[model samples]
Target: MAHLHCLPPSVEPRVSEHMPQIIDMIKQIIDSGCAYSIDGDVYFSVDKFSKYGRLSGRKLEDNRAGERVAVDSRKKNPADFALWKSAKEGEPFWGSPWGPGRPGWHIECSAMSATYLGYSFDIHGGGMDLIFPHHENEIAQSCTACENSNVSYWIHNGFVTIDSEKMSKSLGNFFTIRQVVDLYHPLALRLFLIGTHYRSPINYSDVQLEKASDRVFYVYQTLHDCEVLLSLHNNVNRKDSIPPDVKSCINKFNDEVLVSMLDDLHTPVALSALSEPLKIINDLLHTRKGKKQELRIESLAALEKTIKNLLFILGLMPTSYSEVLQQLREKALKRAKLTEDQVLQKIEERTTARMNKEYEKSDAVRKDLAAVGIALMDSPGGTSWRPAVPLAMQEQQVVAV
Candidate 1:
């Protein structure tokens, strides 16, 4: 999780230690006439809360009444869910006025949030599956206990699915971070997750992961190219002389990126916004299409800085671009079953073939390397190779789809 840059919790609140708060919360709802106790278990009466189904957008009558009746006959309403569950044989019990019982799962969440953040707080977040019963019950519990709540926003992101089915542990379908990161780069996973809108379900597949990894490599490669070009012209101080078109492009990119982020954290569009600027930078670096050399270099420099700032906001590149590139290359080499020396040996062979004007042999060598998941990129500096997803694996994905 830390590899993904998620912050560590400041304090870990356990349900056992917060029994007092849970008991108090249960008492508040009971006193407000929204809950009732039968034997040892207490249930929150769904009929008592007028706004009970607001969060879930589910009507009380929409329940499985025609399908099957709830097994618990003691409850006043079938919709009423437990605030506390009576102790079963040999189970842990807590001291409560309603007898020795533990807090219900729903009530536990309400108590924890209300205890630390107070009955009124800014936000409450959970998955879409928790909308019904869980968050709905929480709303009923909190508001009935305190009359009002300021849980200003409710953000529910869509689930990650495996082969179009929701990935869940209970369903025996899920992937762990450790399992994935062992194969692909961690940021590739991060990129894959955020590539879609938060409200849209993202399909998890090898093809999807490979696509994300490729994009990550492209971004880092662009950054590396920028670094190389900028270093060569470090003495070129012509920021003020940047062409109007280039400045306009950078300004437009800045606006679009921020606007996309602000529009409900739409990261897909934000990520897409990087493409144009990156293309402009690459064009300036490689080709001088109808522009002064100095002006083109200056424009390239400006665009690179703008992109770096954009990357800063996105938390994409946390370290030197070359280091990340090397990490990807090293991982790629291992996957390709080739060492750096072996890659160098191939490169040397290709160089000799080309020097001797042996085109067929050079092409053969390139093809052989590519067959083992390597791509050779020829530049003025020389030829270099990086790990690439094999065409055979990608073809299998197309057939699967």
Candidate 2:
């Protein structure tokens, strides 16, 4: 089982509500002589904790002193970290038994996790950087306050790098989720993230994302084509539908694919399984075997369903049916309110102008529709029009319209 925690927006809100309880716990630890206070501030005594570096394997002597300057000067040992900091002027503060102060960084997670997940929980997870004094201190604080080790498992996800450099806002290489989603489909982004193991660092670049997008689009196109073929043969009975061998193939895929997913979320192996069924579906659609028509239809339907379900689980399904139709309707509504006949006549005129090589007139007509939020695409089959809703408006209108 897995659990997720989204921390409060600011530490101040948590401090205002939980500081008193934490202060009392610290006082109790002090009474036990495990914690000490100096100049109205409190710090945890790392030497008293027996299992201090068990997680990171950094012994006291092996620990290189952090380069960052120490914030407070009153600590007995240089490595002793603050349990509570006296509030500075104009900063958010709560009334504590010690004084008006705020809880230190490490105390919040210990207090909140204990309050919600109880003194003992199955797992704790965060970025790799937190393994240090952050998680180490959390372990010490919770074990001391709750009188039992609170967390059973500690999981840390690796960092994201860009262009062989660590992603950092100060270095100007950081990209937000919203910014990345704007450039490529969300499914492509997810595929890129999962391409590497969760414990390995992920390197970000446009070339990599483009390759991922292409692969995802190929899968989607295969599924879409299979759906179209299956819709044409739905009238066949089960026995007359796809062949027994194809049915067996699909069953095998389901069992193997599901087992992989259930084991440890092995998505890459699951994705690989798709190729076999995709090829089988394509073969059934193109082979024109009159005797196996029914079997082919069954196989096609099962394959399409499998692809759709897997894509949904991966959060990569395309826009919904109603969403696509709504976009179509909005595009139709944005045209000049010509009668059906008049619209047909305009389309004919535009077609003729293009046929006659009247490039300026053809361009003008396309621009006219574009101004009203419709876009036209020219393909070998014919012209197709879609709504040109601004990207920002598309998200808002998808739900409302």
- Winning candidate number (TM-score): 1
Predicted structure with the largest lDDT when compared to the true one = 1
Per-residue accuracy of model 2 over 1-401 as CA lDDT, tens digit each: 00011235333345456765677667766776667887668898888888888788889887655568744566766677888888899988776766777888888777777666778999788988899979998888887786875677776777899866889988998998777755555556777776665566778876565556545655665666676666676675555355677778778888877986775666666776777787777776656573366555566777778767876675556655344334333324433343345444556678899999998998887777655444566867777654353322333311100
Q: RMSD for all candidates, in order, please.
A: 3.2, 8.4
Which portions of model 1 show Cα errors greater than 4 Å? 65-70, 170-172, 231-238, 290-294, 352-361, 393-401
Q: Number of clashing residue pairs in every model?
A: 0, 7
Tens-digit lDDT track of model 1 for 1-401: 87665669766799999999999999999999999999999999989989878987889988764245445889898778899999988989898998997999888888888878887877677788888768888899889889976588787889989989999999998989898887778777787887888777888887777667777888888878878877887786565778788788888988988898889878888888888888887777666573445587778778888887866676676577788778777767876789999989999999999999999999999988887678898989999887676666656442110
Worst 10 residues of 2 by lDDT: 392-401
TM-score of 1: 0.90
